[model samples]
Target: MKESITRYQFISLIILFEFGSSIIVGLGFEAKQNAWLFILLSMAGGLILYGLFTRFVSFYPDTPFPQVIQILAGPVIGYILVWGYILYFLYISARVLRDFTILISQTILHETPLFAVSLLFMIVVGFACYLGIEVIARSGELFLPYVLLMGGLFLMFVFIMDLPKIERLEPFFNIGVKELLSLVFPRGVSFPFGELIVFAVIFPHLEHPLNSFRYGVIGILISGIILLIISVTILMVLGPTIAMNSTVPLLDTISLVNIQGIIQRMDPIVIIIMVVTGFFKITIFFYGGVTMLQYLFKLPRRKSKGLIGFIGLLVMTVSMLISENIAEHLKEGLEIVPLYVHVPMQMIVPSLLLLLLFIRKRKIQKK
Candidate 1:
């Protein structure tokens, strides 16, 4: 297991992890009409949560979150907490893989079998995981900047094509503050930002543990800003009505770009961006799950490769079995499950662990 990953590599993985899932189909649910505003508010809220999660890590710089939980909550409670997180990571990875396959089928290769596409994606991700964290991290470093730059350039083209309308964003707060705040919780805030909880496991592996909090917060902020931009871009170009109705708002908006008809059909660029970012996101989740399992079970380092492969296969199978259609899959992902399952794991559990840690510290001081 290669232990040394550069700062840039780590930063890229963090960025990819945050941006990957949201950028792909987030607009689908966000509904471009006011999606951008939701994104902005979500980012602000996400940053606050990111700060709290980072603070938790910073407080116990030398210990991984699992160990911190164990010390604070006792072995039984801590093990359950760790297991919950592990399950969360695995579920997220499976959902992402499912989402990616759905996108590919809908957009790029409509004729390809879902199983084939899913299998190929899992194979690549499994190989990357097998190569260890350093390889995955470096690959992120190499690809993420290009992905971001390309996405920016694509949006710039959309703007230049005269597709965006400032007036489309008019009638602001049309949903009222109550509805807007409600939108932020399940759709905007929890999904992307709360997902950063996975970083708790990876935090201790950083070359400089103390710096993890700084870089992690910065990474989340940057990803949020980009997501905000994407939301705004989609809203402006597609208009609220069309954007709200479209399944892939960003891709649909890209399809509308017509630079004298010669530069038309640039939706493929969106596909490229999706694929690259999706790959990075899944890889990081896979690595996080594998690492946590190994640490929890005291498995040998060399065993992670096989374990990751098994996990990938399991995810691929689960992705196929989980939902009957994309709509149902997304309904669960964006609506029902995030609030009930993810919020507790990502936000509530960590807060509980932090409180326990504080109490323990006071107890030790008194002794």
Candidate 2:
């Protein structure tokens, strides 16, 4: 039987996945005190991109993403494109895994090798993948509340300590409209929202596929609001200069919480957020790639441990080998990947696909 998930599960996954790496890295630092504006703008951009995705999925609710590609683009070209997405998804999976392991190494695991942390992390994520998307959805549902509660608690502590000074957000429009618009595009939107492209594979599994769009919209808005609050909090607490300069802005923001020094060092809260959201993010991409490969070769859903194992190993290796160090990894992610990889995959391709779909629909209606 094909695995399916409820509408609630679907919403949970989207929220958790959106929260993924976005929380850890922070967004729109270029705008400084006005970083919140960037996230708010990017939320709109994310909704537009998401509308494209859910619209595409709606065209073929029951079909796998690869098959939809073949139907839309023809067999040969679609086969090649499907392979491209498989590689893209796997590459992104590796990138996010690297993101998490780097955080671990920098924080608590200072003495441990990154390779060891990554290996262990990948093993758990890979196991979850092997169990299937149903497992992933269920896990997301189970963990969503815990993640939200911890996040809320952290915020409460920050406020209790009176760390956030609303005055720090003075001179909100530090940059002009044109300059601020540039900061939100491609990079700001790409990191978290554009990454939702991978969910094309999972949308087909929703029990009520027609409602996927509504769930997705709600999920993004909820997560976006949460992120907006956090981003503003970071800015207000740390001030624009320090928040902009900090590597992990959220971590730094949380570390400052001190209730008479007794409730100090809330770094673990950030760590938990990273580990949970990172797992969801990486595993979704990993599953997308693995699922695409399975569909391409017409493999049976059951008894695919061998393929999962091989792909898991590949993801683990690529995570470590992708960059020389955290600096290089972040540099590639911030500077290089957004324009070249993200813009093409997340923006251009989807726009073209939607255009073609429109043309095809018109032709059929004329007949």
Which parts of model 1 are misplaced by more than 4 Å? 27-33
In order of appearance, the predictions have TM-scores of: 0.94, 0.98
Model 1, position 91, has a per-residue lDDT of: 80
Candidate 1 lDDT by residue in tens digits, 1-367 = 3376666777888788877877766542353456767777777777777676767666687676677778777899888877887778888888899889999998878999999999999999889877777778888889887888888888889988887889888876667778778888866778777777777766776788778767877787777778777778787777777766667777888888888878888888888988888988787777677777887988776767768778888988988987999889878988887788888987788788778868877988999
Candidate 1 colliding pairs, count: 0
User: Can you write out model 2's per-residue Cα lDDT over 254-322, one digit (the tens) per residue?
Assistant: 888888769999999989988999999999999999999999877776777888888998999999899
Q: Cα deviation of 149 in candidate 1 (Å)?
A: 2.1
Error of 2 at 77 (Å): 0.8
RMSD of 1: 1.9
lDDT, candidate 1, residue 120?
Answer: 99
Backbone clash numbers for all candidates listed: 0, 0
